[model samples]
Target: MTQQASLVALQERVAAVNDVLNATSVLTWDSRTMMPAGGAETRGHQIATLTRIARDLLLAPETERALEEAERAVLEFAEDSAERRMVQQTRHAVEHHKRVPASLIQERAALRTVAQAAWIEARSKSDFSIFSSFLAKTVELSRAYADCIGWNGHPYDAMVSIYELGETAASLKDLFKELRAGLLPILDDARSRPQPRSDFLFRDFPEEGQRAFGLSLAERLGYDFRRGRLDTTVHPFEVSFTRNDVRITTRYNRNYLPASVFGTAHETGHGLYEQGVDQAFTRTTLATDLVGLYAVGGTSFGAHESQSRLWENHIVRSRTFWQLHFPELQMHFPDQLGDVSAEEFYRAVTRVEPGFIRVEADELTYDLHIMLRVDIECALMDGSLAVNDLPEAWNAAIKRDLDLSVPNDAYGVLQDVHWSTGYIGSFPTYTIGNVMGAQLMETLRRQKPSLDASITAGEYSVLAEELRTKVWQHGRRFMRDELLERITGRRLDPAPYLAYLRSKYAA
Candidate 1:
């Protein structure tokens, strides 16, 4: 077969795999959002069936033949060319999947929905026992999967690589250590200041109003409603079937204003990344996380989180954002925020208050939350931590790190939806994203001198377009460090991020 034809043949098989995965995503999204609680078991089975089918199709002999032919066909292409990246990533995924049994994949996929359902119940009741067995099984499957993937350092390294690719437990430890050194002083300085008046933030603002404001905020930030949407979920997330149809969900807190506002912006950042991916890459390897078996366009979990954190904290939480758009927000919650000024609101949102929830954590205390999770995750994966002991470990970490006592499992071990959904090693990516987002923003400020002015004027498209060209357009063709090096002339340095925190909070 001709080189072009051979590449096309491989792409066709990949597109099929992408379709099945996307179908699975649709079901997953439904299970999380609209599905009745009673449907969890059947939904798990449905997702597992599709997941196994996708995996089988990806590992088929026909796909191997096509991949072989495409590998030779793309040899003459540039190393960074999309054609080459497609074949390289696919081959890597196929080899990686070959190491594990198909049944394991099915088991893991099936457990996610049921576990998530159990988690929701457990969290609502402030009880960990309901979810402990499911979590133990999840940890077991994760360990087995890690062994299959073969890790030299810690089994958690294998799990981390599944999401962040190149990150390991050791590397995360170093990163967290550096971050803590920089953040601790800032946290101290910020805490020393008189706290901002945030009573208005807790006033009752109806959910309808919050959703309306969130929708407007998303639109203003260049989230295309034509290709995407915002919905309410217990936990906020962004998912895309392809570049054409991306959806984001954010949970609302009627008594806490920033919850939906920042959650929407965070998930909008994720949606923007998915929507910003080049259309040509749709249904291709560039838009699909073959290893994670998820139909996503972002290169890595960290890269994706960078976008979310960038929009949520760097932009939306900035003084300029509230200064420019606070009037509209006040219009939505006139009684609640009418007496509040823009600067006061910004300070309230940005105040360095350590919180029980990671998603609602202030920027300064956020990474500490991530570090706590990573420590527990590592201990869990290595058999040093037991499932029954999770609440104690979580509470201890909170007290040691944030000087807070855990009120309940709902506010402690059961807070995050990640572990229940089998995202074992993904917690560190939140901090990674914060670092990467700051690094990218630092570079962006240097490259585009008008970045601040544009953002101040609420012209987010200025920053959005820059990211689309530099980061989003390439989809998953480049690794996280590669993207960083190409754009920032450095690879995942924490210096810029630390500098950003220092300037914002300490200095």
Candidate 2:
């Protein structure tokens, strides 16, 4: 076959596979967002089937020959052309999937569907017993899959690499140590000070007003509702079927207003990143080779986390941000916030509180939640921590780390959807993003020192446009390391982030 013919075949294959994968996303999204309890079992099988189909298409025998032809053809293009990059990406994914069986992938997907439903029930009932068996099944499956793909010594390393490419447990330990060292002193000092009274935030906030206000704030964060929408979920998250169909979810709390305002902003950050990817790369890997779109997908989990943290922590929780939006928020909940000044409100919301739920954790105490998960998950994988013992260990870790007591299983082990979804080694990425987001914000502040001024003026598009130009438009065109360096002139460093935290809270 002619080289051009091979490239054409490769594109067609990629587009076809993406269609199935996107379909899987749609079904998964529907199940989470709209599916009835009666359909959960069937939906699990349907999602699994679609996942397997996508895997099969990508691994078909003809793909290897086509990849070889396309690689040659792509090299003939300029070194930096998108077509060349796509060829490199497709090849990397094909090779990686070769290492793991398609059946295993399908099984994991099917289990995750049922497991997620189980988690919802378990969390609702606040019963760890309901989810424990599913957790064990997932851990076993994940362990097997990790062994299959390869692990140097720690099986969790392989699982983590599935998310962060080259990240390992030890490396993450080092990163966390760096983050903790910087975060600790500030946490102590802030605790010693007179804490801000934020009782207004926990007053009665009606759901409809909260949703409407959250929707408006999401758009201001640069979420394009034309290409996206917001919904409710058991656990708040964002998903993208394609650049054109990015969707976000936030679980609102009537008593705690930040859950709507900041939670929606967090998901909106993810939505904006998805919507900002160049339309040219739609239904295709952003680049070929170093990591295919799949590996790129891995990079994205962390990258996307950075976006969410930036919006949620750095911006939404900032005093200046509230200076502009406080009145608007007051209009929505005057009974609750009418007397609260922006400064007092900011201090109230950002007050450091080590909590049971990771989703609602304060910025400083948030990583404490992740640290517990990483240790517990690693132990689970290594046979040191049994699934049945998870709640005990979890409560102990929370006590040890945050000095907070776990009252029950829901707040302890059944809180997150990650375990049920067959994901491990991914928790560290949130901490990584927390640090990276801080560093990136430092760079952003330098680039646009007037960022606070614009924000205080009820303007945020400038920040959104800046991120789009520097970080979002490329999609997976670059690896995470390369993308960070390109944007910030340095790879992931926690120093800038630490420095920001100390300066902000200390002052």
Candidate 3:
């Protein structure tokens, strides 16, 4: 066949591979949010089969030849266009998929399926030992994955790449080192300040009221209920199989208000990003971040965090924000919010607190939570840390950094399910994204200084639209660094994040 015909065939083959991936994505989303316990085994096999088929298609010799033909054509035709970028991205996927043994791919898929099931049981029983072996297997799988993928910088980099796309161990180390140096002293000073009163937030907020408040907040933020539905899950997360079928989950604590409220806001931010991706890009090679994996990795995650943080901190916790919504809150939880003034409520939510669980950690100590997790992941990958002793190590890190002790395993090691899924060296992205969010917010404020006023009045679409224009619509079309530079006029600077924390906590 002519090279042109070969390239056309390859395009069809690539689309078929993407179709399988997209189908599996739908199944995975369903398995996580809606599948019954009885369906785990069947779903596991289904996902495993689809993954193997997709890998084979991706690794096919014909596909490789087509890619070579396409590469030559792209280089000769439109090397600087988005089409060339898509070709390059396809090449990257082909190379990465071919590097690993198909057996390794299938094994990891099966293991992840089992591990997730075991994790659900262990988390339910609050028994770390039940999941320890599974976690060990996960570690073994991750180690093999690293070896298969290979890394120029660190073994950890190979593992981290699946999520962050181009992030290296060496780069993160330098970034985190600078972040720690700047943050630790400030947290130390803030720890000595009188803690703000937040009795209102800790008081009983009926679950029904929390759901109503969350749904209302989502609607106000421009989330379409027809496209997305909020539900309860063991952990709060947003999963979207398609733009129109996105789903978000939040866990509610009847005694703590922000858990559900901010969780909803955070996941809603994710949903908004999914929904905002230009519909025309859907089902094409350009559907997601095609700029570069690393760029897409950093900016997309950062963008999601920005939306969540904007609604959670800049809007939900603001005094004026409280004034506009406090009456509704009072109506929902009369006994809880009746005596609380907006100033009192705002101070309460923003109070500096060092906590064991990263998700529940307040703003001042949130990055510290991330740093501890980063250290632990690095240690676990490098053979210095053992799965069995993770709990003790976890408590030690908490005590050293937060001046707190683990009251129980539930609130300690079992708190986050990230490790259960073999997500190592990924937590730092939360801190990185938080900083990026603040940077974007700072830039947004400068561009539209009245943004705070709109947020205060519970008008979020204007700000959401602003973000949709600058960040969301692109959908991984630019590398993370270039995207940040494009939008904020600077590289990834943690100074804005540190500054935001300092002003909020140390001031």
Candidate 4:
């Protein structure tokens, strides 16, 4: 086929594949949000069948020929052509899927659906045992997955690369070591100092009021409700069918103010990234961050998480941010927050209390939660840790790191939704997000020194615009390292993040 014809063929095939994929996305979203309890098994099978179809379509013999032909033309015409990126995306998915059998891939998808429903039950009961069999199957499936794809000494290298491209067990260990050492002094100092007294945050601020305030915050921060939406979920997340249909979900705790507020802000960060991608890429394969294992590792989850962390921790938790929003918060619950000063609220929100929940952790100890998980995941990958012993190991790690005993498995090994669906090696990206978030902020401050003032004024257009221009619009056109360097003029550095934590938590 002529290269031009080949390029057209590849695009047509990818668009067809995306139709199956996007429909599957809508089903998955509905399953999570609106599907009836009795529909779980049938939905699992339906979603898996669609997943198999998409996988097979992507790896079709004709599609491969078209991609190969188009790739050559793309390189010859211009190395950075969008055509080249698309081929790279196609080739990555083809190669990864080729390693595993079609039936196994479908089974894994079905298993994930069942595991998620089981997790909700286990979490509600706060019983790890209730989730134990599902967890075991999840682990076994993960191992089978790694075994199918083949691995060197580190099976998790492939596992983590599923979410964070180009990252490996060795690289993360080194990064985590540096992070832990840097954070220790900050954590120690923050703990030694008296915490700000703002128990009013736990006052009875009705759920309806909290949700309304949270949605308003999301809208103010460029959420574009006409194009996107906010909803309730057990674990907050953002999902998108296309740029114009981004949806985010957050759970609420009426007695704990920060729960819904930060969760909404965090998911909004992700929504903004999705909504900001080049409109040209929407509804295409290059659109969703869920385009995992599709390329060598473009748009790392760490990079994506940085947007959520940046908005949730650095901006939303800052004193200046409260200067603009505290009144709105008080308006939501006057008796709960009317007398609370903005600085006091900021201090309360930013408080460095070490806790069991990773999502709700303070900035200082947030990464420490990731560190524990990284260690556990590594041990699981190496066969040093048993799946059944996870709760004991988790509790021990918590006690060692935070000096807190585990009261139950829900707050211990069963807290996160990642593992229920076989995302064992992905937890560390939250820490990576923290590091990258701070690094991005450092770069942003240099570019627009008045960015904080804009945030303080309840005018975040400047910050949103900067991130869109520098980071979001390109989507998978660049990998994580390439994106950071192109946006910040340097590679990832832990020093800035370390310094950021120290400055924020200094006694």
Candidate 5:
């Protein structure tokens, strides 16, 4: 076959796999959002069947043949070319999956929905016993998965690499060490100041007003509603079937105003990345996570988180954002925010308060929440911690890290849905996102001298276009570090993140 014909054949095979994965994503999104409680079991089986089908298709003889032909066809292409990278990535995923059994894949997929349902009930009842057995089974399957994939260091390393390639327990420890050192003093400085008047933030605001404001905020931040949407979920997340259909969900808290507002901004950031992917790569290997069996366009979980954190923190949380948009928000909730000023609202939202919830945490204490989760995940994977003892371990860590008492399992060990959903090693990505987002923003500000002015004027297209060119357009064509190095001339570093926090909080 000619090179073009060979490449086209491989693309067709990969696109089929992408379709199955996208179908799985659609079901997964439903299970989390609108599915009835009793549908969990059948949904689990359905997702498992689709996941197994996608895996089988990826490893079939036809796919192997096409991949071989594409490999030879793309041999003369540049190393960084999308054609070469697609073949290379597909081959890696094939090899990776071949080491694991189809039964194991099906089992893991089947457990996700059931376990998530159990987690919701347990959380609602503030009961860990209700979910402990499922969690134990999940940990066992995760261990088996790590063994199948083969790991030389901590078993958690294998899990971590599944989400963020090249990250391990040891490496994250080093990164967290540097971050903790820089953050502690800054936290102290911020805490010593007189706290902002945040009483207004806890006042009653209707869900209708919050949703209207969130929708406007998302649109203003460049989230394309034509190809995207917003909904409500227990945990906020963004999922994409392809670039053409991306959806985000955020929870609403009528008693706390920042929950929906910032949550919408964060998920909109994720939607923007998916919507920003090159249309030419749709349904191709460049737009699918072959290893994770998801039709996501971002290069990695951490890279995806970078966009969410960037929009959530750097832009939406800025003084300029509230100053420009606060009038609209006040118009929505004139009764609740009648006495509040824009500057006061900004200060209240950004106030550095160490909280029990990671999602609701302030910027200074957010990474501390991530570090605590990483430590517990490592212990769980290594068998140093027991499943039943999780609440105790979680409470101790929360007290030690955030200097707060745990009120219950719902507010402590059962807070996050990651474990139940089988995202064992994904927590670190939030902190990595913070660091990467700051680094990128620093580079962006240096390169675009008018960035602050544009932001102050509430014009986001300038910033959005720059990010689309630098970070989002390539999809999975580059690794996390490669994208960072290409944009900033360096790999992931904590200096910029620490500098940003220090400048914002201490200075």
Candidate 6:
């Protein structure tokens, strides 16, 4: 066959692999949100089988030759066009995939499944010991996976490359250091100031009303119900298989009014991004390879976090958002909100709460939660920490960082399910994403000062559209740094995030 024909065939093969991956993603989502407990073993086998298939297809020598040939054709014919971009992306993914052993791949998938089951059981019983052995094994597998990926700076950096390309531990450490310097003082100030009137936030709220408020908020933010659905999970997450089948799940706390509302808005931010990707790239090599390249479209885990945080904290917690919805809050909890003004409600939700649970943490204290997890993950991955000692270590970090004590393992080490799923070295992404979101929003505000008014008016189209144009639509066509610079004219600096915190809390 001619070289052009060979490249076309290679593209077809890559598309087929993505189709299998998308299908597998759907099953994985079900395993988390909808599947019954009895189906765990079968689900494990299914995920393992599919993972092996993807590994083998990407590892196949014929596909490797085809990819190389395709790259040559694109470079020779199109130079620096979209065709070459597709070839470069395909090559990059296969190179990393080739580095990871198939045995390790299958093992991680199987371990994650069983570990998830054990986590569900442990979390239900609030018993960390029940899941300790499984978690230990998961950590072991993650370390091995990290070594397979290889890194010059840190093993954690190698692991991070799986989710965020071209990011290093040193880079993140420097960013966090700058962040820490700015944040500690702001936190001190927040502590010194008169506390906001948050007593009203804990007032009795009906679950039905909470759900209605969340759905209405999501709709106002442009979440498409036809293409996506929201459900309740123990912990909230958004997982997508394709544009038409994105699912977001949130946990509802009846006692706390903002849990479901903000949680849904956060996950919806993720869902909308998934739904907004370049639709024309669907079912192709250009499609599956697109998401990780851009700085805005979760260009990094931090980029994704920015969207969630933007919606959850910056917008949802803002006085403007409440001004638009004080009536709704009154409708839901007339006894609670009738006497309260919008400013009071805003300050209440935005109160700086030092908490053990990361999900329940307020915006200011949230990074401390993330830093605590980052420390634990780093220790666990490097063999300095033990699974059995996790609770003590967790409490120690919480106390040192937030000056708070943990009352139980449920509220302490077992609060997050990330460890149960072989996702070591992933906790930093939450804080990093928060920083990225704040920085991006700063740039966005400069472009459109009326964002506050737009948010209050319940019109998020302009903001969402800007993100789609700058971040989401490009998919993974550019490197994270390249994309950030291209879109925002600045690198990914955590300083903006820190500045944002200082201005909000300290000022």
Deviation from native of the Cα of residue 241 in model 3, angstroms: 1.5
> What is the per-residue lDDT of model 1 for residues 421-463, given as tens digits with 9 covering 90 to 100?
9999999998999999999999999999998898888888999
What tens-digit string does per-residue lDDT give for candidate 5 at 77-190? 999999999999999999999999999999999999999999999999999999999999999999999999989989999999988999999999999999999999999999
Better model by lDDT: candidate 1 vs candidate 3: 1
Residue 497 lDDT, candidate 4, scale 0-100: 92
lDDT of each: 0.94, 0.81, 0.74, 0.82, 0.95, 0.76
Tens-digit lDDT string for candidate 6 (320-368): 7888888886887788788899888878877887877788788888887
Candidate 5 clash pair list:
none
Candidate 3: which stretches are off by over 4 Å?
1-14, 76-80, 288-303
lDDT for model 6 comes to 0.76
TM-score list, all predictions: 0.99, 0.96, 0.91, 0.96, 0.99, 0.94
Give the Å shift of residue 441 in candidate 4: 1.2
Lowest lDDT block of 10, candidate 2: 287-296
Model 3: clashing residue pairs?
289-476, 295-479, 295-480
State the displacement of the C-alpha of residue 162, model 1, in Å, after optimal TM-score superposition: 0.5
Looking at candidate 6, what is the lDDT of residue 411? 85
Give candidates' CA RMSD values in order.
0.7, 2.1, 3.0, 1.9, 0.6, 2.5
Go through the candidates in order and give the clash count of each.
0, 5, 3, 0, 0, 4
- Model 4 scores worst on lDDT over the 10 consecutive residues at 289-298
Estimate, for each residue in 1-507, the C-alpha lDDT of model 3 and write its tens digit.
664665566567666775677677677667776788778777778877887887887778877887787777666656436556657777777777767888877776666656777778787787889888988888887888888888776688887676566677787888888888988888788778898887778887889999998898888788888988998877888765546666778888998898897788778877887777666545445453321111121134555666666566656656677778777877888888888887777777777786666777787777778777778777778779999999899899989987898886777777887776566656767876787788888899899989878876777888899888887776645656677798899988888878877777655
- Which portions of model 1 miss their true places by more than 4 Å? none
